[model samples]
Target: MNSAKSPAKKSWLQTLIKNKNERKKVIFIFTISFLLVVAGLIYIPIYKHSLPLDSKIYEGNFKELGSIARIGFFAALAIYPIFLLLKWKPLSHIKKGNFELKPLIQFLAKYVRQWHVPIALISTAMIILHGYMALIKGFQANFTYFSGIITMAVLACLLVMGVKRYKRTDKKWHLKFAISFLVLFMIHATFS
Candidate 1:
């Protein structure tokens, strides 16, 4: 009978309450990512249908590629935050023989933590393709265009830093650059 109530089959909320902070952070990031994508989906058709053809700002000239890139970008944004959750304090407490968690949580965390690098590499490819279509195809240098360039440059620096995994490198720069890129991305997306 105890097997039926095992943690493995518990609702996500139950598992989450046990691993509170990390789960909360993951939920928050997922919520934001979902909202951003949904907002884009809602806004795109309305923008196209409601506005004049001349000012249809985001017909996204490259259509399908643009759509795929936008989705990939939001997905990457969502995945990046989950990295923090992988650093479990419980792991250190294991030596004390006092650790307890659902097997499902353990499995999920391990899978997510292991995939961070791969997710980043995939996101990079999608962003590169998106950038190429947006900036290189016609090569327009404006506020919208330059903001994207700056964001992309910083994002590339971040990827290099992640790959290097330098013990001595100050991590604040990573946080700072990420915030900077986010602001730049907002501006770029808004004006583009």
Candidate 2:
């Protein structure tokens, strides 16, 4: 009788309320990263225009790259939330310790894990592309360049550590590195 009601009688909201700490952490990480990305998009152009005319990176014709950078920025900005939503389903399961390594769950984890790195890479790439354009057509390469470099490093670390986490069947390093990278990248993006 108890086994039968176990799945049906439990409410999702109740479960969240019970594990508020983890849920809060998840929300915090997502919110901070989202804000940073959005903020970066807004400030990048202003920073670029602040560059001196003689800077090698900021002096080139960048109309096309600028347009592409805009597209890339918006695309990256939009896709991140969707990716988070998709992973949220499984994340809830994992948090509940209900993650059975069955074929379906395994398959979902595989695809979702694969999806994350490329999205992050593309997002970082777009940021870099934007920075490159700014370097050539604007004066302030210091902030843009430093931000781009840090973003790339964070993404790369996330990817490498991510692969290890997935294959090792451990979530410890995954959470540590993933959260660290996200936080650091957000800071770099927003501060630069």
Candidate 3:
């Protein structure tokens, strides 16, 4: 029953998900997400009071936790460097026509696989803490909290999917979830 001109059954999204270049694009998307989160935190005043005499981040014991969260944010942002190094070695290997990726890629991939769960958990916690700080400051506006909340949720889902994929030993689905999460996070960051 097959015809020479039989049409492709897969949708465009399927095609996109299967694209080879999507791997590196996914990494860059996360890099941009990291930058956006960092930038937003920098420019936005974290604590706003809905009521008089409320605790401000600068003037209270909250400062310590805030500092810790800030440190975590910076660390999370810094992790992108590992991604860059991973990409560099593989890209160079590929460019030289070596079908075999550098051994470093395996090392990097192992770290990327093993670390994602804990990283996502800590990152989710930090985002919550940051949101709490934001709340103490009265930033309940639709755009701020809603977008931030959505972004965190998307990231959490992505992390869970990623971890599941890793356990199932499926690289394709892992990258798909990761890329979708990155895209959602970026949109969320932009709105926030």
Candidate 4:
């Protein structure tokens, strides 16, 4: 009886892997797990006093420059997701034979796509500067710092995926990374 159940269990697992929605759920689970592990790695050292913190370094205009960088980062980060919404939402409508807004959606999507790469590049630079300003003031083991590091790592992956997508060397990973980055960035921003 145990042997008879073995193939059935294996087939069930295989079927789950083959299903698109199930596959997505599995991928999401794995992604979240990986991110949690990363956060733990970052948080544990600071929690244990292995990491040094010097609050004195926060002097000077670092705060002001960090604020400016934050503003620039937000501005650039805001645009790309609009493009994704514009590009994607219309497709579902179109599938249902609703073409009333097709032309307008396409036009907006095209315009947004044109600006996406440039804005992303600018945002990357702003984030780098922002990170430098913060770290120069010493590392603080807080939600904001932890989230920021994870968000930055996600953004780096997003940038690489974006470049590969642009060069036609890949397609789907860029969107995945973009969504991940957006979610992580939101968390980071909220804590800040």
Q: Against the true structure, whose TM-score is highest?
A: 4
Candidate 3 Cα deviation (angstroms), residue 187: 3.2
lDDT of 4 at 5: 44
List, residue by residue over 82-139, the lDDT tens digit for candidate 4. Answer: 6566657545465445555566666766655554554455545546655755775568
Model 1 per-residue lDDT tens digits across residues 32-93: 54565456455545664554434334335444454565555555554445555446566544
Q: Give the whole-model CA lDDT for all candidates, comma-separated.
A: 0.57, 0.52, 0.55, 0.60
| Tens-digit lDDT string for candidate 2 (21-56) | 544544554465567556756665577557554555
Pitting candidate 1 against candidate 3, the one with the higher TM-score is 1
Better of 1 and 3 by lDDT: 1
Cand. 1 TM to true fold: 0.49
Scored by lDDT, the top model is 4
How many Å off is the CA of 186 in candidate 1? Answer: 2.9
Alpha-carbon lDDT of model 3:
0.55
Q: Candidate 1: RMSD over Cα atoms?
A: 13.9
Of candidates 4 and 1, the better by TM-score: 4
Looking at model 3, how many pairs of residues clash? 2
